[model samples]
Target: MRPVPDRRLWLLVLGFSVWGSALGFVYVLHSVGCAFAWPANAIRLGLGLVLFVHLALVGLLWRSYAGTYPGAPAVDPTDSFLNWVILWTLIAAFVTIVFTLGPTLLLTTCT
Candidate 1:
Protein backbone atom coordinates (compact mmCIF):
# COMPACT_ATOMS: atom_id res chain seq x y z
CA MET A 1 0.00 0.00 0.00
CA ARG A 2 1.17 3.57 -0.70
CA PRO A 3 1.93 5.69 2.30
CA VAL A 4 -0.15 8.76 2.81
CA PRO A 5 1.40 12.13 2.03
CA ASP A 6 2.53 14.22 4.96
CA ARG A 7 0.14 16.82 6.30
CA ARG A 8 2.94 19.36 6.33
CA LEU A 9 3.54 18.82 2.64
CA TRP A 10 -0.07 19.53 1.93
CA LEU A 11 0.06 22.66 4.01
CA LEU A 12 3.15 23.85 2.17
CA VAL A 13 1.59 23.30 -1.23
CA LEU A 14 -1.68 24.95 -0.29
CA GLY A 15 0.01 27.95 1.25
CA PHE A 16 2.33 28.47 -1.71
CA SER A 17 -0.47 28.13 -4.23
CA VAL A 18 -2.72 30.58 -2.40
CA TRP A 19 0.04 33.13 -1.96
CA GLY A 20 1.11 32.89 -5.59
CA SER A 21 -2.44 33.32 -6.80
CA ALA A 22 -2.97 36.30 -4.54
CA LEU A 23 0.09 37.94 -6.01
CA GLY A 24 -1.13 37.29 -9.54
CA PHE A 25 -4.61 38.54 -8.76
CA VAL A 26 -3.22 41.81 -7.43
CA TYR A 27 -1.38 42.54 -10.70
CA VAL A 28 -4.33 41.46 -12.79
CA LEU A 29 -6.61 43.81 -10.89
CA HIS A 30 -4.20 46.67 -11.44
CA SER A 31 -3.92 45.94 -15.15
CA VAL A 32 -7.67 45.79 -15.54
CA GLY A 33 -8.11 49.08 -13.75
CA CYS A 34 -5.50 50.76 -15.92
CA ALA A 35 -6.97 49.38 -19.10
CA PHE A 36 -10.22 51.22 -18.39
CA ALA A 37 -8.50 54.40 -17.08
CA TRP A 38 -9.82 53.98 -13.55
CA PRO A 39 -8.82 56.62 -10.99
CA ALA A 40 -5.31 56.28 -9.59
CA ASN A 41 -6.49 56.40 -5.99
CA ALA A 42 -9.07 53.73 -6.64
CA ILE A 43 -6.50 51.38 -8.10
CA ARG A 44 -4.11 52.05 -5.26
CA LEU A 45 -6.79 51.41 -2.69
CA GLY A 46 -7.81 48.17 -4.32
CA LEU A 47 -4.23 46.97 -4.62
CA GLY A 48 -3.56 47.96 -1.03
CA LEU A 49 -6.45 45.86 0.13
CA VAL A 50 -5.18 42.92 -1.86
CA LEU A 51 -1.70 43.32 -0.36
CA PHE A 52 -3.11 43.43 3.15
CA VAL A 53 -5.03 40.24 2.60
CA HIS A 54 -2.00 38.57 1.08
CA LEU A 55 0.14 39.50 4.05
CA ALA A 56 -2.44 38.12 6.42
CA LEU A 57 -2.54 34.86 4.56
CA VAL A 58 1.26 34.70 4.55
CA GLY A 59 1.34 35.30 8.29
CA LEU A 60 -1.00 32.42 8.89
CA LEU A 61 1.03 30.17 6.62
CA TRP A 62 4.27 31.11 8.39
CA ARG A 63 2.74 30.33 11.74
CA SER A 64 1.54 26.97 10.50
CA TYR A 65 4.86 26.07 8.88
CA ALA A 66 7.19 27.34 11.59
CA GLY A 67 5.06 26.33 14.57
CA THR A 68 6.91 28.66 16.94
CA TYR A 69 3.79 29.70 18.79
CA PRO A 70 2.20 27.69 21.56
CA GLY A 71 -0.24 24.97 20.46
CA ALA A 72 1.03 25.13 16.90
CA PRO A 73 2.05 22.00 15.12
CA ALA A 74 5.69 20.95 14.98
CA VAL A 75 7.82 22.20 12.11
CA ASP A 76 7.98 20.07 9.03
CA PRO A 77 11.00 17.88 8.40
CA THR A 78 14.03 19.73 7.09
CA ASP A 79 15.30 16.82 5.09
CA SER A 80 12.53 16.82 2.57
CA PHE A 81 12.91 18.73 -0.71
CA LEU A 82 9.31 19.79 -0.34
CA ASN A 83 10.27 21.74 2.74
CA TRP A 84 12.86 23.67 0.75
CA VAL A 85 10.32 24.30 -1.97
CA ILE A 86 7.97 25.76 0.61
CA LEU A 87 10.64 28.09 1.92
CA TRP A 88 11.52 29.30 -1.57
CA THR A 89 7.87 29.74 -2.40
CA LEU A 90 7.39 31.94 0.62
CA ILE A 91 10.40 34.04 -0.36
CA ALA A 92 9.16 34.41 -3.93
CA ALA A 93 5.75 35.50 -2.68
CA PHE A 94 7.29 38.20 -0.54
CA VAL A 95 9.39 39.44 -3.44
CA THR A 96 6.30 39.52 -5.60
CA ILE A 97 4.50 41.55 -2.96
CA VAL A 98 7.26 44.14 -2.94
CA PHE A 99 7.31 44.38 -6.72
CA THR A 100 3.55 44.58 -6.93
CA LEU A 101 3.23 47.36 -4.34
CA GLY A 102 6.36 49.39 -5.03
CA PRO A 103 4.88 51.12 -8.07
CA THR A 104 1.82 52.26 -6.15
CA LEU A 105 3.99 53.82 -3.50
CA LEU A 106 6.31 55.60 -5.90
CA LEU A 107 3.96 56.53 -8.75
CA THR A 108 0.71 58.43 -8.65
CA THR A 109 -0.53 57.80 -12.16
CA CYS A 110 -0.99 54.79 -14.37
CA THR A 111 1.30 56.26 -17.04
Candidate 2:
Protein backbone atom coordinates (compact mmCIF):
# COMPACT_ATOMS: atom_id res chain seq x y z
CA MET A 1 0.00 0.00 0.00
CA ARG A 2 1.26 3.46 -0.87
CA PRO A 3 1.41 5.58 2.22
CA VAL A 4 0.29 9.17 1.94
CA PRO A 5 3.08 11.57 2.77
CA ASP A 6 2.83 14.19 5.50
CA ARG A 7 4.07 17.11 3.42
CA ARG A 8 1.61 16.56 0.59
CA LEU A 9 -1.32 16.59 3.02
CA TRP A 10 -1.42 20.35 2.93
CA LEU A 11 -2.90 20.17 -0.53
CA LEU A 12 -6.12 18.94 1.01
CA VAL A 13 -6.71 22.23 2.78
CA LEU A 14 -5.82 24.44 -0.17
CA GLY A 15 -9.44 24.82 -1.16
CA PHE A 16 -10.56 25.99 2.28
CA SER A 17 -7.56 28.27 2.50
CA VAL A 18 -8.51 30.06 -0.69
CA TRP A 19 -12.10 30.41 0.45
CA GLY A 20 -11.04 31.82 3.80
CA SER A 21 -8.72 34.26 2.13
CA ALA A 22 -11.52 35.43 -0.08
CA LEU A 23 -13.83 35.89 2.88
CA GLY A 24 -11.30 37.94 4.79
CA PHE A 25 -10.37 40.03 1.79
CA VAL A 26 -14.00 40.72 0.93
CA TYR A 27 -14.76 41.67 4.53
CA VAL A 28 -11.90 44.11 4.52
CA LEU A 29 -13.05 45.53 1.23
CA HIS A 30 -16.56 46.05 2.55
CA SER A 31 -15.37 47.66 5.75
CA VAL A 32 -13.11 50.06 3.91
CA GLY A 33 -15.77 50.95 1.39
CA CYS A 34 -18.33 51.60 4.09
CA ALA A 35 -15.88 53.64 6.13
CA PHE A 36 -15.04 55.76 3.11
CA ALA A 37 -18.72 56.19 2.29
CA TRP A 38 -18.36 54.63 -1.13
CA PRO A 39 -21.48 54.89 -3.22
CA ALA A 40 -23.82 51.89 -3.08
CA ASN A 41 -23.21 50.94 -6.67
CA ALA A 42 -19.44 51.05 -6.26
CA ILE A 43 -19.47 48.88 -3.17
CA ARG A 44 -21.75 46.34 -4.79
CA LEU A 45 -19.63 46.28 -7.89
CA GLY A 46 -16.50 45.77 -5.88
CA LEU A 47 -18.02 42.95 -3.93
CA GLY A 48 -19.22 41.30 -7.10
CA LEU A 49 -15.82 41.59 -8.69
CA VAL A 50 -14.08 40.17 -5.65
CA LEU A 51 -16.49 37.29 -5.47
CA PHE A 52 -15.90 36.56 -9.11
CA VAL A 53 -12.19 36.41 -8.50
CA HIS A 54 -12.63 34.04 -5.57
CA LEU A 55 -14.90 31.79 -7.56
CA ALA A 56 -12.37 31.73 -10.35
CA LEU A 57 -9.65 30.84 -7.90
CA VAL A 58 -11.63 27.96 -6.48
CA GLY A 59 -12.42 26.81 -9.98
CA LEU A 60 -8.77 26.80 -10.92
CA LEU A 61 -7.81 24.84 -7.83
CA TRP A 62 -10.51 22.30 -8.49
CA ARG A 63 -9.57 21.99 -12.09
CA SER A 64 -5.86 21.68 -11.49
CA TYR A 65 -5.80 19.14 -8.64
CA ALA A 66 -9.09 18.01 -7.25
CA GLY A 67 -8.24 14.32 -7.52
CA THR A 68 -5.42 12.09 -8.73
CA TYR A 69 -2.27 13.79 -7.71
CA PRO A 70 0.60 14.11 -10.12
CA GLY A 71 2.82 11.03 -10.53
CA ALA A 72 0.47 9.00 -8.42
CA PRO A 73 0.52 5.28 -9.06
CA ALA A 74 -1.90 2.44 -8.58
CA VAL A 75 -4.83 2.66 -6.18
CA ASP A 76 -4.22 2.60 -2.44
CA PRO A 77 -6.75 3.12 0.31
CA THR A 78 -5.03 6.10 1.87
CA ASP A 79 -4.47 7.81 -1.44
CA SER A 80 -8.08 7.23 -2.39
CA PHE A 81 -9.36 8.73 0.83
CA LEU A 82 -7.09 11.71 0.50
CA ASN A 83 -8.23 12.34 -3.03
CA TRP A 84 -11.89 12.16 -1.99
CA VAL A 85 -11.32 14.57 0.87
CA ILE A 86 -9.60 17.03 -1.40
CA LEU A 87 -12.41 16.84 -3.92
CA TRP A 88 -15.11 17.37 -1.30
CA THR A 89 -13.30 20.26 0.33
CA LEU A 90 -13.15 22.01 -3.02
CA ILE A 91 -16.80 21.32 -3.66
CA ALA A 92 -17.83 22.43 -0.18
CA ALA A 93 -15.79 25.59 -0.43
CA PHE A 94 -17.36 26.48 -3.74
CA VAL A 95 -20.91 25.81 -2.55
CA THR A 96 -20.32 27.68 0.69
CA ILE A 97 -18.94 30.78 -1.01
CA VAL A 98 -21.89 30.86 -3.33
CA PHE A 99 -24.57 30.24 -0.73
CA THR A 100 -23.17 32.40 2.07
CA LEU A 101 -21.76 35.31 0.12
CA GLY A 102 -24.23 35.35 -2.73
CA PRO A 103 -27.06 36.77 -0.63
CA THR A 104 -25.03 39.86 0.11
CA LEU A 105 -25.43 40.88 -3.50
CA LEU A 106 -29.20 40.93 -3.20
CA LEU A 107 -29.40 42.68 0.15
CA THR A 108 -28.42 46.26 0.92
CA THR A 109 -24.79 46.68 1.83
CA CYS A 110 -23.51 48.50 4.95
CA THR A 111 -27.03 48.25 6.39
Candidate-wise lDDT, in order: 0.66, 0.83
Candidate that scores best on lDDT: 2
* Predicted candidate 1 versus true structure: per-residue lDDT over 1-111, tens digit per residue: 334378856755665576677768777987999999998888888887877887778766665545343333553445344555665667666666667655664576577
Candidate 2 local lDDT, 49-75, one digit each (tens): 988999999998887665575346675
Using all chains and alpha carbons, the TM-scores for the candidates as numbered come to 0.62, 0.85
* C-alpha RMSD (angstroms) for model 1: 4.7
Error of 2 at 51 (Å): 0.9
